[model samples]
Target: MDEVEVVVAHSERTTLRVGDVFLKVDADQSRLDVEVAAMGLAPIPTPEVLWRKPPALAIAAVPGTALGVLGEPSPASPAAWAAAGAAIRELHDAPLPPWTSRSVEEIRVDLDRECEWLITNDVLPADLIRYNREIAEIALRPWTPVFTHGDLQITHVFVDGDKVTGVIDWSEASRGDAMFDLAILTLGHEEHLADVIAGYGDGADRDVIRAWWSLRSLTASRWLTEHGFDPNTPGCEFDVLRTAFEAARG
Candidate 1:
């Protein structure tokens, strides 16, 4: 008998693994709808959807380990990172998804709100918040939207022997800035940015990508805390923010 393993659990959702099948349970059906639809439309590899029964979607596990995890050193080689980047380029080059993504204004507003919360709650020093907020501004500028894996965390990408095997967790998939996907994938793994950009071909702005790193970390810290996650873990979001601060000063 295959014992169930809890992959992730939070107020919003829970994912369980039973042998080769992964079960995702979310009260919000819309996210599941997006995940299923995005996988169908995506040109790159995605997990096979075995079946779905309202509030629970089952998928067959794809081969290969995750590219990496947050707050940890990646076991994957530079070649694997480059392969993930190439796959991202393919996704961005595909036709846009039917759904609309949040506008720059919306993202800015969210950033402002999250920044204030950080200051008001004393989550981070006001100076740190202000500095990162300034850095975050660069990403607010306009850009051509692409078919993006909206939450392309390294853990969502799988690789085997320097080749990208699959990318999972497509609920956040939508039309968005391509750089945001690249930034998210290499958030804490900045050392691999060059390899990813090399595989992505061209048109990458390093400053903008770094700015997105600050913006994403600042905005996500509060939510991560509420969800019982520790963004302050070494090599995680807080570290990313601190690194940005240091770079600005030096």
Candidate 2:
């Protein structure tokens, strides 16, 4: 957006590329931007990318829009959500050899710390927290953790006509309880969220999945806050989490 042409690419990493060259900015808090571009040719799930000059980092020349329409509110029928579930199942099923595994014992090892987080932030709830823990222990009992999309949902899933074209944004991809991804996607505002998950080739527990999502609200809030990102910022689910936090208190 400076003298250089800038495009809003599907990526948020601040990168700059000129011709075959790439540029990256490594500043955390300087006059310039913090999310610098790094040259990467690795497999990514989005249509556009951000780049930088001199091939140092990835940069954006043109502001990019999502390749397909979103928020159209036209459920491609439960059939589409059903398909999306299959695609996600396959994705979750992929072996993440290079990635470390995740399990309840691993995440819960820090339970005392995670629980202290809610209390310290004044977002802790007694009944809700108790129920959340019980549900997690039960739900996570059946499924082994895997590398997940972390934020899979209707908005992040792109469909072309009836086919799922791409699963965008791997910024949050990591080893976690598979239920973590299922929790967010199957809940929220998607009208067909439940129907779709139920249609997965294998029956998945929905209530337990929802519990995983409810537990992460505070976890994400703390993670973002520490990283200097506000969860309540517009376009994010912070306010909705605020509602959940209050409901938990109730």
| Predicted model with the maximum TM-score | 1
lDDT (10s digit) by residue, model 1, range 1-250: 9999999999999999999999999989999999999999999999999999999999999899998899899999988988988999999999999998999999999999999999999987899889999999999999999999999999999998998888999999999999999999999999999999988988888999999999999999999999999999999999999998887789
> In order, what is each prediction's RMSD in angstroms?
0.7, 7.1
Stretches of candidate 1 exceeding 4 Å from the true structure: none
Steric overlap count per candidate: 0, 40
lDDT of each: 0.94, 0.51
Q: Count clashing pairs, candidate 2.
A: 40
Provide the lowest-lDDT 10-residue window in model 1: 241-250
Query: Per-residue CA lDDT of candidate 2, range 40-117, in tens?
Result: 211223434454343234433322222222223444656666666766777667664244445567666555466576
Assess candidate 1 and give its lDDT. Answer: 0.94
